[model samples]
Target: MSLTDIINAVVSLKKDEVVENVISEINKGTQVDDILDKGLIESMDVVGAKFSSGELFVPEMLMAAKAMQAGLEVLKPHLSGDATAEKGTVLIGTVKGDLHDIGKNLVSMMVEGAGFNVIDLGVDVDVEQFVTQAQTQNADVVCLSALLTTTMPVMAKTVEAIKEAGLKVKTIIGGAPVTEAYAHQIGADGFSDNAPGAVELIRKLMAA
Candidate 1:
């Protein structure tokens, strides 16, 4: 399949078609990451913008993200074992005492779709876990999610742990209660209220 076709698949949120054709194209020697960036990732960049502008909503954005992941799975085998060439490494998770993962899951998919090697620590992740895993993976970014007002403090504690450990992982925090003002107050490197914004913020942080 052509790269444009892959892009269309992502744009249309066709998970099955994208994964199938992407694998077919990969077997023909097209560069996997190029297929990813030019096609799926680029499509998701559009999805993100559409979502922010109210042109799309949670369900549509979630489906597009799912389609992108399907394509990524096809390329993952080819992507493995080239650690030195990765775009960046990231550690992401939802904070402890919060069982909700919809937002966290979406952000994880978007981050992986952007070609970062993501280490997902899953839900109910403790602050220490964030610090430990970021250090362990030598992650360029640490993304925290908390869907409830009560759980949002987990983000701050997570940040503190990273600071206390003297880790240089650039922190990004978001969820229902998270705001750019709150983010800045806590000294977070970045804050995103949505998945695409998260991905965009990561790109900016990496570029900086």
Candidate 2:
């Protein structure tokens, strides 16, 4: 089967088909990174565009992300260290005092689909945890998410702490209440309002 077939499977939300096709491609000696970037990652990029155009919604995006993750599971073992380093590492979480996760989960899946090695710290993550994990993981980017205005300040604190720690990782922030202006005011390296945009934001930050 062609890589487009796998991408179509993911976009159609056919998780098992994605896995089976991915394995088939691997057995046929297809390069792991090619399948990931051309099939899985590109599918999400399309899905994100559809979402932006009102052709798709949250539930549909979630299903597509799930399908991509299924394919990723089959390809994980074949991903060499050099392959991962090429995409860079990402450390992501909901800032302190926040329980929201839907946005964060979506970003995590899309970032992974975009070829990054993502370490998700889950919700209600403390500022110190962000710094500690970013350092421990040698992350190339640290992302914070918060849905509440109250928790927004924590994002700034986390960014400051990362800077204070003198880590070289770039910092990005996002969520329902977050904006590009807020990102700049808080000293974050980047901001995205959606999952697909999050992947793009991370790419730009890493490039910079």
Candidate 3:
């Protein structure tokens, strides 16, 4: 499939075709990060815009994320096994009391697609878990996600744990219930509204 076809299939959530095409590109020696950034991530950016504009809904975003993950599975082996290329490490997870995983999964996939080596701590993760993983992995960034209005406190607690440790790690927070204001109020280093933007925002955090 063409690169554009692969991108659209991901954005539109055309499942099987997206996976098949990403592999095709990989076999052709296309750079994995390019396929992700120029292709899959760009498509997700559109998906996010559609979500904001009401042209797409949660179900569509989930399906598109599924397609993105499929593509990532095909490209991951080639992208992350090198040493000279320092993409930085990030520890990520959904905070406790938030069982909603669709958003968490998309953020994980998009972060991997953005070229960082990510450690996913899974859903319902607690504050101690976030700090422990960040410490264990020497993570460059710590990301906490929450889907409910009530779980925002968990994000704050997670960041607090890292801050208390006196680590140099940057913290990022995101979810439907999260905003830049709330992120700042909670002392998060950055905030993003969607998966692609989250990935880009994390990149910016790491760069600084």
Candidate 4:
């Protein structure tokens, strides 16, 4: 089957079918990166667009992400170092006192699908935790999520802490209560309103 066939399967949320197709392609000597980029990652881009356009909802996005992950499992081992050479590492989490995580989880999945190595720190992560992890992991980007307005200041503090520590990582903030202006005021390198946009923002920040 063509790579687009696999892409279609992922978009349709056929998890088993996506896994089978990925394995089949690998068996046929298809380049692993090609399968990941053309099939699975591309499918996520489409899914993201559908989500942003309101053509799909959270349940659908989650299913598509699951399908992509299923295919990723089959391809991971075969992906050599060179295949991941262009990918950057990201550390993501919701700020301290913010137990909300749906948005953060979505960003994690989408960023992973975009070929970045993601370390999800989970919800209620403190600034010290964020700074420590980013330093330890040598992450290229630090993403903070805050759903509550009260937690917004915590995100700012987290950004400030990372900067003050002289960590060589770009910071991005997002959530229902976050805005680009807020991100800039807090010294965040960037911000995005949705999961897909977050991936793009990270890409730009890394490239810069």
Candidate 5:
């Protein structure tokens, strides 16, 4: 019946309630922008905070993101072009030789929830694809994920390729094996170990 109801439903990871509340808000003639911003997006912000504070875990965060996605689906049809204008474009994918995606998938959802237009290139993505997509999509940031130590070298190669290509896009890397030191050693623009921190890092990179 209210935006707060939608927010609560998302925070509680109730997909049905979130969808119901979103539909109710739309039926009540609420602004789609308000429903998106004050309702769904704000819910993710709260979820992100809880995650940072250790009150939520990956499974819980995934559920909350799913709930938020449900609300977004209902609102999508009603959303005006301006209402869905993204803050920036983020190109995310797992580097070549690594197929793991739980962390990548979580970061993709979290980044999208934060209002960035995300292009997920899936697993085993090579440096050529990364460079090509960044150019074609006009991405503001390229996020590389690697779950294996062996695959971590590809992150560096991709970063080098992006820079060598003379593209202005910022590059970020993450995964269980990735560290700030490795990110620096590889000449990446930023690094994050968790999804929420990835969102924050992207925001900071965009602002810079």
Candidate 6:
């Protein structure tokens, strides 16, 4: 019935309630931008905070992201071009030789819920595909994920390729085996171990 209701619905991971509240708000003549920013985006911020504090885990974060996505879908058609304008374009993937996707998927969903235009390259993505896609999509940030230490070198290779290709995109690395030291050693712009933190890192990188 209100933006607060939409926020609460999303924070509580109530997909149905979030959808209903979003539609109700639109019917009530509420501004699409307000519904998106104050309702949906803000809910993710709260969810991220809880996640950072360990009050919520990956499952809860995924549920919240899903709830927010549900509300976003309802508001999309009503949004004007300017209202739905993306903050930035993010290209994300699990690096080649690494088929793990849970962390990559989580970051993709969380980043999308945070209002970025996310292009997921899926698992086992190679260096050329990443460079080509970054150019093709004009990505602002390229996120590399890896679960196996053996595949971590591909992150370095991808980051090198992006830079060598003269692309102006920021590269960030993450996954269980990735570390800030490795990110720096590989010449990446940043690194984050968690989904919410990755969203925040992307935001900061874009802002800079």
| lDDT winner | 5
| lDDT, candidate 1, 1-208, per-residue tens | 5888887787788899888779878888887657766776677778877887998898998888788877776665565232345689989898999875656766777677677898999999998888878888899999988877899888888898899899978999998778999899888998987676888899899999
**List of clashing residue pairs for candidate 3:** none
- Please give the CA lDDT of all the candidate structures: 0.81, 0.86, 0.81, 0.86, 0.87, 0.86
- Per-residue alpha-carbon lDDT of candidate 5 for residues 1-208, written as tens digits (9 for 90 to 100): 6899988898888999999999898889998778877888789779878988999998998899888887777776564433156899999999998876756876787788778999999999989999999999999999999977899999989999999999999999998778999999999999997777888999899898
- Each prediction's number of clashing residue pairs: 0, 0, 0, 0, 0, 0
Estimate the overall C-alpha local distance difference test score of candidate 4: 0.86
Model 6 compared with the native: what TM-score?
A: 0.61
How many Å off is the CA of 132 in candidate 1? 0.9
Backbone collision tally, model 3: 0
Give the poorly placed runs of model 1, Cα more than 4 Å off: 1-85
* Candidate 2 all-Cα RMSD: 6.9
TM-score of each: 0.61, 0.61, 0.63, 0.61, 0.62, 0.61
User: Where is the poorest 10-residue window by lDDT in model 1?
Assistant: 76-85
Task: Put down candidate 6 lDDT per residue, 42-155, tens digits, no spaces.
Answer: 787788789879999989888888888778767755654321557989999998888766568767877887788999999999999999999999999999999778999999
Stretches of model 2 off by over 4 angstroms after superposition: 1-86
Clashes of 6: 0
lDDT of model 2 at residue 168?
91
Give candidate 6 regions above 4 Å deviation: 1-84
Q: Write the per-residue lDDT of candidate 4 for residues 87-156, one digit (tens) a residue.
A: 9899999989987676687678778877889999999999899999999999999999997799999988
Q: 168, model 2: CA deviation in Å?
A: 1.0
Candidate 2 on 54-129: residue-level lDDT in tens? 9989899889988887887787666543234449899999988988676687678778867899999999999889
lDDT for model 1, on a 0 to 1 scale? 0.81
Query: Which residue pairs show backbone clashes in model 4?
Result: none
